[model samples]
Structures are given as C-alpha cells and as structure tokens.
Target: MLRKLPLLVGAAFLLTAGPAFAHVGAGPVDTFSHGFMHPLSGIDHVLAMVAVGLFAVNLGGAAIWLVPSAFVGTMMFGGALGYYGWPLPMVEAAIGASVVVMSLAIAFGVRLPTIAAMALVGLFALFHGHAHGTEGMGLGVSFLPYAAGFVGATALLHIAGIALGLGLDRLGNMPATILKRCAGTAGAIAGVSILAGWLAT
Candidate 1:
C-alpha cells in the first residue's frame, strides 16, 4: 500500500479526467437514488472535490476538517439559494471559475490567511452545491442520499489528497516549490478546460 501510494494518487487525474465531463448536471435519473450518483458523473466535480482534501492535508490541524466542513456547510447554503431561485448571475461561469482558481491554490501553494481561505473555499462550494441541486432537482433522487453521496464521495477524495500529501512529505522531503508547480499547472489546465466548457455550453 505504501509503495503504490504515489501511483494511486498520480492516477487520480487520469481516472478522474476520463468521462469526467460525461455528466455535468443530472442528465437523467428515475429515482432519488440517481442524485447521489450525479457528482461522480463529472470529472470537474471529482477533481474539485479531491482538491479540497489535498489542500486540507497541506494546511493540517483544524484545517483538515475545517476546510471540508466549510465546504459542506456552505454548499448546503448554495443549494438553498438554488432551490429558492435566488438569481445568482453567471452561475455556470462561477462554478467553472471556482474549479480553476482552487486548483491554482494547490498548484502554487498560494499562502492565504486561514479565515480568508475558508471563506474563499466556502464561496466556491456554494456554486458546487447549487449546481448539484439544480441538476438533480425533481429527478426522483432522494435529497438525503444524494447529498450524502456527494459529500461522502467528496470527503473520500479529500482523504486521498491528504494521504498522497503525507506520502510526499515522507518520500524525499520534496520541495514545496515543486509541489506548487505541479498544482499550479494542473489548476491552469483545469481552468482552461472549464473555460472551454463554459464557452461550449
């Protein structure tokens, strides 16, 4: 398990990238059960979800939970906003931008005040949650189970990010510089992809 850790983490992008965009919003779902599965249908959601965990590992301490917590809490808020038709402008673009920006955070190891970081991430989660709600709406997907699946899967991804991050700490005392570069590059690419998606959509 230890030796293969790197390969496993590295493969996240490859596995996630495939058929990731295959489903942005819930295309179809007869039962409420499908709502729970919608988040996994897209790569952007998967990567964004995982990035939260990877970043938490980097931040450590209360952050491990705080960050993800903020995401969950705020996501619910976003969902509520959507449910009520709050009228947020440029919602799709915002969602894509969140993915791009957050990816850059990990890629560059951008140092931000903890409070600021949480707020930034939480804001992004709102867009995420809103999308989830909108996509799964009236799809027969159980709200509870759907939220659970989305949150649970996202948490699992975060754990993977933490594990990989810990592995990096042990492997070679890898330079922060290097990690930032990789993260930044990945983020840039994600951002571009998201931008393309927005344009196409």
Candidate 2:
C-alpha cells in the first residue's frame, strides 16, 4: 500500500483540481505538444485513462493488452467524428460516467469476459476521443500530430496504471486485492466528485 501512495495521491489531485474539459481549446503550439498536454490538463481524462489500465490488470490474460487497445482504437475513431464535427451528445457527462463505472469495476473486482470488457472500454473511449477531436477543431493538418500526442500520452498513463496494479497484486493475493479495492474506491469517489463539480459549474 505504501508503494501505491504516490499514484493514489495523484488520482486524488486529479479529482480535486483541473477543469472537466481543459483540453477543449489548447492554444497555438506544436500540434503534438498540444494534443499531448490535453489529456494531462484534465482530471477526467487522467482518471479514465488510468482506470482503463487498472481494469485491464484486474481482468488479467489477453485482456491486459486487448482492453487498452480497444480503448485507443475506438478513441481514434471517435476523435474522427469530433474532428469532422459530428455531434456526440453528452460527451463530458459520458466521460465522467465512464470513470465511475470503470473504477467501480476495479473496486469490486468485477471480471467480465474479455470481449465484453473490451467493448465496455471501447464504448467509453469514443467519448474520450471525441473530446480530444473537438478540441482540435480548426487545427486541420495539425490534428494528426495532436491526436498522436494525446494517444501517446494516453498509452503511457495506461501503462502506469498497469504497473501499479501489477505491483500491488504481487503483495500476496489478499493484500493485493484489498489495496486495489482501496485504490478503486478512492477513484470512484473522485469520479463522483468530478461529476458533481461539473454539475455545479
């Protein structure tokens, strides 16, 4: 549990600070940098991306890679919709909901079939990608690099979650399970806090 303190603290910080969609209009800058920074700028993105990784580790097996892949791939497709100005209703709300659902899944040690897990994360990724896409609105040619930047950042965050999850799991089954649940419960509370913040705003 001590080993996981930093990550838990960071997640808590995400819950307490930053805008829901801080990436919506990143200023003029290198497209890649802009995109890369977007995910880091918001609490919602960090929580959801990291939670996907935790969920993957909880599922175990091929799901470790497949689930994250599903999210990234589907997220890109959703980004395209946003880039093209296709409307996705309730994107912010959906993103918040994703955090709540995914974190709770981890908290409870819920294990769905690999395909179902993939689909669940993939569905969440759409809204995430759309948020990224819509942010790059007029970037035109720069959108690709911006998209790449965010994708790269998302992948890194997922890996971090996986590493932390795996590390906790190594502490012995019961201890690991307890720690993961504690982390997930914190994440779920944070997610709810974020949603309430959004509603208040």
Candidate 3:
C-alpha cells in the first residue's frame, strides 16, 4: 500500500492538471449542479481542499472537526464578501500559497494547537471562497443556492481526504506518515505549478 502511494498521488495530479477551460462553463446552468461542480473544476481547489483534511488527520483530536468547521464557516463569509464585490487583495497568490503551505505541513507532520490549525485553515478558506463567490456571482447564478452547492461540494472533498487519511492510518503510523508525505510532495509540486502560472499572468 505504501509503495503505491506515489503512483496514486501522481495519477491524481495528472488527472487534474489539464486545461481548466471547463470552469468557464461552470455557471452556465445557474443551478445547484453548477455550483457543486465548481470546486472540482480546478486542480488548485482540489489540492487545497484535500490537503486540509489530511492536515486535520495529522493533528488528531478536536482538530479533526474544528479545523474543517472553521474553514467552512469562514469560507461562507468570504464568499459573501466576494459576492458583494469586496476587494480581497492577492487572492490568487494566497490560494496558491495555501496549497503549498498546507501540503508542506502534512509532509512534515507539523502539529499545532487546534485553534492555530483552525486559523490557518480558515485563512486559506477565505481566499478559496472569495474566488468561488466572485466567479459564481459573475455568472448570474442565485447566490444562496450556489453557495450551498459549493459548500456541500467542499465538504465532500474534505471527506474524501479524511477517508484517505483513515485508510493510511490502517497501515500503521510510520508507513502512513510516509505515504501522506508523498501525497504532500505531489501537492507541493502542483502548488508551485499553480503559482508559476499566476506569476506568468
């Protein structure tokens, strides 16, 4: 199982690294489905979302729930700000940095107090939510339903990360840790790529 971890992460990277032109049409339907699919449309969102779950798992205890909860709550707030056309400077850079930092946290097995972890996660969520909100609103979708859909989708992605973390735990601490680090390394590489793209633009 541990030996295959790299391959799994690599496959995920490949699967998500393609042209993100699909997101251009994400709001075309202006329905719950469109909102739900928005996060999954970008590799950056997926990596950051999944990395949050993995980070929580590494932290253990109340952090497992609190961290993600903070993220969801703050994300909604951030989305509202975006919907209102509020300025959030450096959103794209922040989002890319979030992936890099969170992935490195997992890779190094960094543990923080639950509050600190929540803060870190919440900060990242703000950028992500702002991006989603700005994009969704621009498409003329109903804000409430679109928010609900994307929030639900984000939760699902976190759950997926939790599930993966749990599966790794079954392999015992050392191997699981190694595997997670491999996954994080992949995330870091992805983050660098994302940041580069933003820089180029």
Candidate 4:
C-alpha cells in the first residue's frame, strides 16, 4: 500500500494529461517567462521530457545522465533551426511519436547501448526543440533567454522523472519494476491518444 502512492500519482498525471496541447497562449510575450512556461504548458513536452529521464534510469549506468544531456544539447540545436525558420518534416507528428516511442521504451524496459540510447533521444529532441523554436519565431524575442528558460524547465522535468525512478528503485526490485512499467504503459496509452487526436496534445 505504501509503495503504491507514486503509482497513483503517476496515474493521476496521465489521466489529467489530456487537453493541454503544445504552445498554448495568445502570442509570444516575455522571453524568459514564455520559454519557461512553454514546456510546462504542453502535455507532449512534459510526457516526452519525463519519459526521457525514465528511459535513462531504465538503461542505468552512465546512461542515467548521458541520455538526458544529449536530449537537451541536441534540442538546443533543433531549437535554433526552428528559430531561424528552417523547416523540418513532420514536426508535430514527430513530437507525438516521440512520446509514444519513449514511453514504450520505458514500458518494455528496453535497454540499448549508451550511445544508441543517446542517439535515440537526441533524434526526438530535435522535433521538440524545433517546436519550441518555431513558437517564438517572428515575435522579436531574445532567443538566448527564451531558450535558456525552456532548457532549464526541461532539465527540471527530467530531474523529476529521475527522482521518481530512483525513489521506486528503493522499494525492492520487483515492485519498483512493476510500477515503472505501469507508468510506461499508461504513458504509451496517453501518447496514442494524442496521436489519434482524442487527447489533442
């Protein structure tokens, strides 16, 4: 019973995750504030970012940090492309797919080589960053501060996921693994809902 609290919270998050789409607002306003709030505003961003952390923990070893770092670093480059009006194919759909793919990774406890895991998350970060970058384009905003804000926010979300994974790990292997996999399963379902247009993320 005690160990199940986190699972309940995770379930609540997923259930309530519907309805918040990416880039929700009237228009780009404050640079730092908007960037900071942007990732928090969208379900897709939150899910994918957190899933990255969870996936990292699943991989264990150096992957615990390297995977998330690769994502942030690559996302910045992707963000730059979007900010400058460079087009990437299937940006939105790719964002949705990132959630599905990453969540499935967590659900199945998939482990790849550290480099392979880093490359995988890096690929998804490009689309996520592109979305962030494109959001502020044409708004005459300061790219550095805005980018910093989102980067900071993304890192925090990743940390939250890391904390969740680490906390569950203390609860004995079998229970913890079951709960983590359950989270991944729930997240995958939510990702599917977003892709299907039922959740509108």
Candidate 5:
C-alpha cells in the first residue's frame, strides 16, 4: 500500500547505513553526543531495540508500552553495573541471542501475557545495558548527560519500530501479517549474522 512507502524507505536507509557505523566502539563517547550515537552505530543494537518495539506491538494492549518500559528500566540497571565494573559474563552473546529470540517471536506471531513479555525483554535489556555501561566506563564524560542521550536515542528507535508496526496493523489484513513476518525474518537473519560475527572474533 502507499502508506507503507515511507516505512519501507526508512528501513532501507537503516539497513544500508548500519554496517558502515556498526559497533565502532565507545572510545568516541567522550560527550553526550557521542553516547547518543553509540547505539545508532551498532547494527546489533538497532536490530534488538527495534525488535523489542515490534514484539510489543504484536502483543497488543498494554504490552505496547509495558514491554519497552521494562526493557529500558532494566537496561539502565545493567548499565549501572557495567559503569561500576561489575562482571556480567557473556554479555555480547546474550545481546545477540536476544535479537534471535525477539525476532523469532515476531516472525511466529508469539503472544504472551503482558507481564511475561516485559520480563522477557527486561532480561535482554540487562545485557544491552551492560554493554553500554562497560563501553562508557572510561569516557570521562558526565554520566547523567551521557546516559540521558543514549536512553533518548534508544527510545526514539523504539518509537520508530512501533510506528512501523502500527502502520502495518493499519493495513488490517493478510498484507500486514505478511509484512510483519517478513520483518521478523529479516531480523532473525541479522541476529544470526551478529552471532556468527561474535563467534569469529
């Protein structure tokens, strides 16, 4: 449908842009701007974050917000742990796995009670947060502003995902369902690729 044009275009842009900036590292995060750009720089993070939004939308009802909220809140806790130099084993692997789980859920149209959904996303958020925290530790920047920037950017990515989900829902039929599934499949492939890269490195 004509309505899907912009969303498709945006998705295209992100897909193309992601690899060029992928996980460049936290070395540049010496300011709020740098912190904000950190997540955007990584394809893995973007995929997982957007998948969270899609998963929330698929669940419908309060899950639309609750799931993302849980992720954000718990992610902050994980970030704090990272900032304090706490050891969280397998953080990178966990993050990659989150992408696989979330995207597969969307692809299969998996539904759960709001509480369960929140817990699922929250669990993944911890790994994501820890990554940010660990990377940000020695940046010598003001923690509050840096945190705020990254959090704000994350929220924006979620909103973009939700917006796409909502647009598909508006189509109100098999087309929407197919598109959602396609999105999920693409996400799944991305997850697998990230995990593979991690293994190689």
Candidate 6:
C-alpha cells in the first residue's frame, strides 16, 4: 500500500507539471479555459488539493468537510477579486508555496493548529481563485458555472487524496509518519520546480 502511494502520487506529478507551467502568463480565455480545468490543470494544484484530502482523511470526522469548505470559500473570495480586476500581490508565488508547503504538511506530519491549517489552505485558494477569475476576462464563461467547475475539480482531487488515505487504513493503523514523509518529499521536489520556474520568469 505504501509503495503504491508513491507511484500514484508520481503519476499525478507527471500529469500536472506541464499544464501548470502553461497556466502562467496566459490571456483571459487561456486563463479561463485552463483555470476552468485548473485544479486538475497542473501539478501544483493537484498536490495542494490532494494534500487537503490527505490531511482530512488523516484527521478524520469534521475535518473532512471543514478543510475542503475553507478551501472553496476562500477560493471563491479570491476568484471574485480577480473577476473584478483586483490586484493581488505575489499571486504565483503564493500558489507555488501552497503546493510545496501543503504537500510537506502531509508528507512530514507538520500538523498545525486547526485554525492555522485553515488559514494556510485559504491563502493558497486565493491565488487559485485569482488565476481562475482573470483567466477568462470575466466574460469567457458564466462566472457561476465556471466557479462550479473549479470547485468540483478541487473536490475531486480531495476525494482522490481521501481514497489514498483510506487505502492506508488497511495497513492496520500503520504510523502516518511514513505517509507524511512521502508527502513532504514530494512537496520539496515540487517546490523546487516552482521556484526554478519563478526564477526563470
């Protein structure tokens, strides 16, 4: 099961990396078109969304809903800002950081106070929303449906993480330390990639 986790995660990496890079510097339609698919659009989004899922599954109970809800709520707020042509500082940096940091949280068991976790995830969602909002120039698609698509995709990734976490359950309460470690390592690698890209640009 543990071995499978790495492979599953790696597959996610292969799938997301290219699309994510394309997302940077795109026009409204490009942003909107891809942003509509953004949660699954790139590796960074995938890792962050999956991290939320893993954290909830590991936390159990209310956390399952709480974490995801916070993400969606904050994400929507961020989207509104972008749709309205608001300027946000460090948007890409924040998005990349969310991926690297959250993945590490899952991988390394770097549990934060529940409030902290919510706040952290919320921050990430802002950039995500911003990217989505500005992508289509506020006219490429109907805002409600477009927003719905992003939220749905985010939820799907969360579910995938939950599925992976549940699969870990079969290992008979094996220490989550291992899973955390795996998540952290992946986060680090992803973070480096994001940083490198940011630097180049």
- Residues 9-102 of candidate 6 have per-residue lDDT tens digits of 3443443333333443443343334445756657777887888878777667777778878888998898888888898866766676676666
Query: Can you tell me which runs of candidate 2 are displaced by over 4 Å?
Result: 1-23, 26-30, 198-201
Candidate 3 lDDT, tens digit per residue, 72-142? Answer: 99999888787778978667667777777788778877788899789878988887888767766554545
Overall lDDT per candidate, in order of appearance = 0.62, 0.79, 0.76, 0.79, 0.76, 0.67
- Select the stronger candidate by lDDT from 3 and 4: 4
In the range 1-201, model 4's lDDT, one tens digit per residue, is 324433542443344333334542335645778778878887878999999998898889999999999999999999889888999866666677778778877887778889988988898899888877887677564667777889999999898888888889999999988998899898888877876667765
Which window of ten consecutive residues has the lowest lDDT sum in model 1? 12-21
- Any runs in candidate 3 off by more than 4 Å, and if so which? 1-26, 136-141, 198-201
Give every collision pair in model 3.
none
Is candidate 5 or 6 superior in TM-score? 5
Candidates in order, TM-scores: namely 0.75, 0.85, 0.82, 0.85, 0.83, 0.76
Q: Comparing candidate 1 with candidate 4, which one achieves the higher TM-score?
A: 4
How high is the lDDT of residue 53 in model 4? Answer: 92
Q: How well is each residue in 7-103 modelled by candidate 1, as lDDT tens digits? A: 4233423333322233235454334346555666666666676677667766777787788778878988887676555656455555666666666
Residue 161 accuracy (lDDT) in model 6: 80
Stronger candidate by lDDT (3 vs 5): 5
Cα TM-score of candidate 2 = 0.85
The CA-based lDDT of model 3 is what?
0.76
